[model samples]
Target: MLIYHPAFDANHCLYRIVSILHSANKTGVSWSLLRLLDFYYLFPAQLKEISPWPSQISKYKRLLKNIPQQYEDINNSPRVFYDLEKFQKTAVLELIAKGIVSKESFEADKLCLVDDALPPSFIAYMKSDEFFNKDEFKIITEALPMVGLNGPQGLKKRSGLMEYIYDA
Candidate 1:
């Protein structure tokens, strides 16, 4: 019984990771944060429910309102998150192998994009409307600021997707 799912698709995961690193800009994202952010990128509905909303919810009102109902809320997020861990790691490794991301940087715990490694066309596509869901990507961008404010532990707690208490 062959199975096909975006969550298990290497190319899909690779593209998503690239888009994430690109949107993340110069100060690359931490490995843990990348995992968390990728989760939301894959499941925007979960992002809407789990994100730490600002005091001024109006800031995200439009984006939140735009999320289509097709992405129904995920009930067992923790399990799904854990299940995708291996595939996520594989995608990161593929990035390093492809030289799009540096192994040294990833080893140092930050997934930094390699300068000029990606083709200009690819970069343009990432920024264009043709990329995955525009609203979803925007939501990921909007949620990035919280990475600094909450870090991995706080994000895990808020998402209820991991055991952060014992994480050092």
Candidate 2:
């Protein structure tokens, strides 16, 4: 039987990446933080559990409070993160190849949007409540400031998604 998982879908990963970078704006975000945020965005229950909530409260607090319970795949998160690694790389590479995201920023350990503005359609879709869980998106965007509070190593340590001690 064929199975489909968002973790393995390049297009879905691409869309998520774009949404993240867009939320990040021109300031850009470190690759590590992006990966962590991506994981949370994909598995919101995990996000709700581990998020530095006091430091990054969303304006949509009611939405977060009322958020429907999602499966908490905490035990599999690290494995899922690793499993999604290749697809993430693929999505990043495709973005660079298409000139939508900056290769130089990527090489420098950050992911930055090359264009000041995404195509109007993409922007509309990204902003639309119909296409995305608006509350989740708001939460993720609100969390962007945490990228500065923790360096890549610090964020990795916080997430426990990867062994950060030996990371260079």
Candidate 3:
């Protein structure tokens, strides 16, 4: 299953994944691996109206693929299972390649570990005057609910708290 998004590339996905992992590690939150995968898979759908690249509007318009009704119904849907697995692997590989994240423990139950205490270039990229002032954080914040981590006990407290500090 090849799942690609017009609004974001491997860098974009890696940025999100790393940011989540970095925040979770900092906050000591026990985020669910399953929820992380679902968030990445459903991210593109959250930005159906906005194109990351404005010049290529038509390309982005075509890229707004419909999100599955049930992101967590992977067990009953083989296609969903395959897509999520593939996307998660690809995103993780990108994170590793960029040195933003590392597998803390591959055991049956271990959260991902931040590879570096220092911030990655992606974070710098996000903070660069050109992009940072553009309010990309607003888009990311808006997409939180669609990513399915907006519930009170979900990632809102963890990631949201981190975002508040990060934005400040």
**What TM-score do all the candidates reach, one by one?**
0.83, 0.80, 0.39
Clashing pairs in 3: none
Model 2 lDDT per residue over 1-77, tens place: 99776767889999999988887656777776778778877876565454444433444445566555675445677
Question: Candidate 2: which stretches are off by over 4 Å?
Answer: 51-64, 71-74, 129-133, 147-153, 166-168
Q: Give me the candidate number with maximum TM-score.
A: 1
In the predicted model 1, the residue pairs found to clash are: none
Candidate 2: RMSD over Cα atoms? 3.2
The digit string of per-residue lDDT tens for model 1 on 1-168 reads: 985667778888998888888886567788878887788887877766655554433466467777766434467888888888999899999889989998889989889899999989987777674535567676675555444434453666767776666765
lDDT of 2: 0.71
Indicate the worst ten consecutive residues by lDDT in candidate 3: 159-168
The segments of candidate 1 whose C-alpha lies over 4 angstroms from its true place after superposition are 1-3, 51-58, 71-73, 129-133, 148-153
**TM-score, cand. 3:** 0.39
Compared with the true structure, all predictions reach lDDT values of: 0.74, 0.71, 0.41
TM-score of 2: 0.80
Could you tell me how far off, in angstroms, the CA of residue 50 lies in candidate 2 after the best superposition?
Answer: 0.9
Location of the lowest summed lDDT over 10 successive residues in candidate 1: 144-153
Q: What is the lDDT of candidate 1?
A: 0.74
Residue 42 displacement (Å), model 1: 1.2
